[model samples]
Target: MALDSNENSDKSIHKFESMLKTDDVYFFDAEDFEDIIHHYLNNGKVSLGKKAIQFGLQQHPHSVELKLLHVEVLVFEDKFEEAGKWLDELQNIDSHNEEIYVQRANIQSKLDNHKKAVELLQQALELTDDSFDIHSLLGMEYLFMDDYEKAKLSFMRCVEFDDRDYASLYNVVYCFEFMEDYDGAIRYLNDYLERNPYCEVAWHQLGKMYFSKQMYQEALAAFDFAIISDDSFLGAYFEKGKVLEKLGKYREAIDCYETTIEIDDPTSHAFLRIGKCHEELGNDDLAKYYFYNTVHEDPLLDKGWLAITEFYFRKKQYKKALHYINKAINIDGENARYWKKCAEIYSALKNFDEADFAYKQTVDLGNFELDTWKNWVTVLQKTADFNTAEQVLLQAIEFYPEEAILYYQLTLVYLASDKPHEARKKLKSSMELNAEMVTHFKTDLMKYNRFSWITAIFADDKKASA
Candidate 1:
């Protein structure tokens, strides 16, 4: 039976508000003042927090905790000098107090002296018998410095003192991720589970680490334990479903996803995944229904619109694909992938001008791949925009100098513009990069007389062998 601190805090707030309404002399202990002020601060009502501290100080003038909180309020208001003065006075009153050291460390952190803050917190850790908060603060300072290994050790110390410190535990896992030591994370979580086997969150985190490493079976087992520890944990179900999907267990994955929807409200992600699973299982109608449900659940989810668009495109419903992609673009016009998709759909429908515009937008948004540049150049050639195609190839060669295919394609553009010297130069560079792609180049371009330069290279290769 833990204390219902929230209920107590609510009552305290109500009584304080009533006292304010009636102008009555309300009495509250230092702890009550702390809670009331903390409630306001946590809710972003900093003004109200300051008022609480001011009013509480009127009654308990000698309350050191209230004075410390007053310093915090001053700090929050960006009154750093006042906060420092108050901290100095408080240290004189209680030189050995951990809270004073913590406050000073916070001020140092705000001043961008994280190294100084770490030293201050380390001193505080020595002064305190229960150093959970000190360890947590030190870990945050180390994290700010990008010393992930030290940050992880500090958070591990915090978790050792208090296994219920879920935030510190999560930070420990985050530090592991920052270090890219997934094996270390798995070992740490396994050790933590040995101590507190019923901690569902730790199990869930373990599952996530395994999933990242692509150990799908191990991830599935971890998620199963998470669900067993807390049957109502929707995250475990969702994660397990993802692992099942990776394992190609589509029916099992669908069941897990369905269970998540049953235990919690429907999510756009869940609905979309369900649709994908149904599609894999060869149930197009059910897949369509779930895809529709996905957008209905969250109209603003770009993924849902993208999924619906892909579904229509696969079915060769070009008009419907175009409609859905337009809807997606309208929602997130800056999304490069959406523009790229739109370009592909338009190209399939032979809407050359629209496809060219979409491909241009894709490039402008920095969402283009090598294929996008190739497609754009192809469209330009189809529309007899040879000058623009040459310009595009010139720019593309600068970005993709290592790609033999780009140089090969550039040779064609230069030959078309009657720059035979430049064409031969580009052809020589292309052969040097990848002589194997000569077959592909020949198959695509051998019809034109300009392609004679490419054949001359092959002739030279054969002569060298002879």
Candidate 2:
């Protein structure tokens, strides 16, 4: 009868430890040494693994497996040149060994030679009946090459061989997601579930796939199954909460989020979700409490900070909003959204100079949204920085060459700068692009309406159109 692997490993490990304490020699066969070394390496006890390898080779110097284990340890320690030399020596002794090819592939992969690694793995696959590990390695190589289709196939083969291979299953889903093959992913997961029905990880993954497709009910059912399989699965509860929120079940969503907190530590993300749910339910006090909890739990969470800033902004609490937004900016100064928010809050308080600086920061950080440019220009005009306003509008026009509003705004800036020629030129361009938008700035244009040149241009355009 075959020895139980756990029992055998336990006896070998105990014997090895006992021998280490004394100066006595232990008689461990090549396989026992392999398991012992594997145990140390897998558990991240590298020094002990090296010791075990040295002792193992001393006992069985000609054992190819022991030599390979030494090579593995060398690779782990990043002694690539040494490992390669050792592998070459082993290959000469046992060229038919699949492990030689696999270890060579590992070295190639570490060096980022993914294509060469794939070739080596293919050779290993040819030599070995157990292709599961080789397929997993092949999938990773294909992923490194960004060949999602091949990666998906490789990982799927791993899943077929062992349905419990959640890591390979995750890679399969990731490939499908990268390719945006949601239906195919759903189909594959559904088939996987039929064989391994109670796999919480697979069910969690299925829920996310369905959620991506906006199939909320299907997502909810999958998440519920995940929770039923493993009630301690925090991810399922969090996702279930999100699904409930999408379905407008605020109370139920809160319950799910609270369940995650019960299962594990309260995450900033969970607190944020609960806050959003309370906000949806019109429980403003409860929302504010959770929003505070979110930032307190994780001060670095930008989303949590933004939520609090927006909450106060909605209540017209401009000072409070400004305070929280400034805090967010202090945490992530490069965040364009936070800078934009700061600019808007400053503009609301009529702090035009501060607002202008914030707006500049927002643009500098690469936020080229139309409203950002428009709002920044408006702030410049408010501060009577006609020179800078004209410059700002001109820059905005480049990004929005066809946008009539920018041309109209530029016309105003030019008129304010006492450059009627430039103003008329931009006014005509604006009319040409969108004459109807002229109504939006009619009140401002009325100030310059008394100018004969402006009146004449409008008259000529109207006559030409008629």
Highest lDDT against the true fold, candidate = 2
Off by over 4 Å in 1: 1-14, 43-45, 91-95, 107-116, 386-400, 445-453, 460-466
Clashing pairs in 2: none
RMSD of each: 3.4, 3.9
lDDT (tens digit, per residue) of candidate 2 on 146-173: 9999999999999889988899999999
In candidate 1 the C-alpha lDDT for residue 371 amounts to: 91
lDDT of 1 by residue, 328-371 (tens): 88888998888988988989998888888998999999954889
Q: After superposition, how far is residue 380 of candidate 1 from its true place, in Å?
A: 3.2
Q: What lDDT does candidate 2 reach at residue 15?
A: 93
TM-scores, all models, native as reference: 0.88, 0.86
Q: Candidate 2 — which residues are off by over 4 angstroms?
A: 1-7, 363-370, 384-466
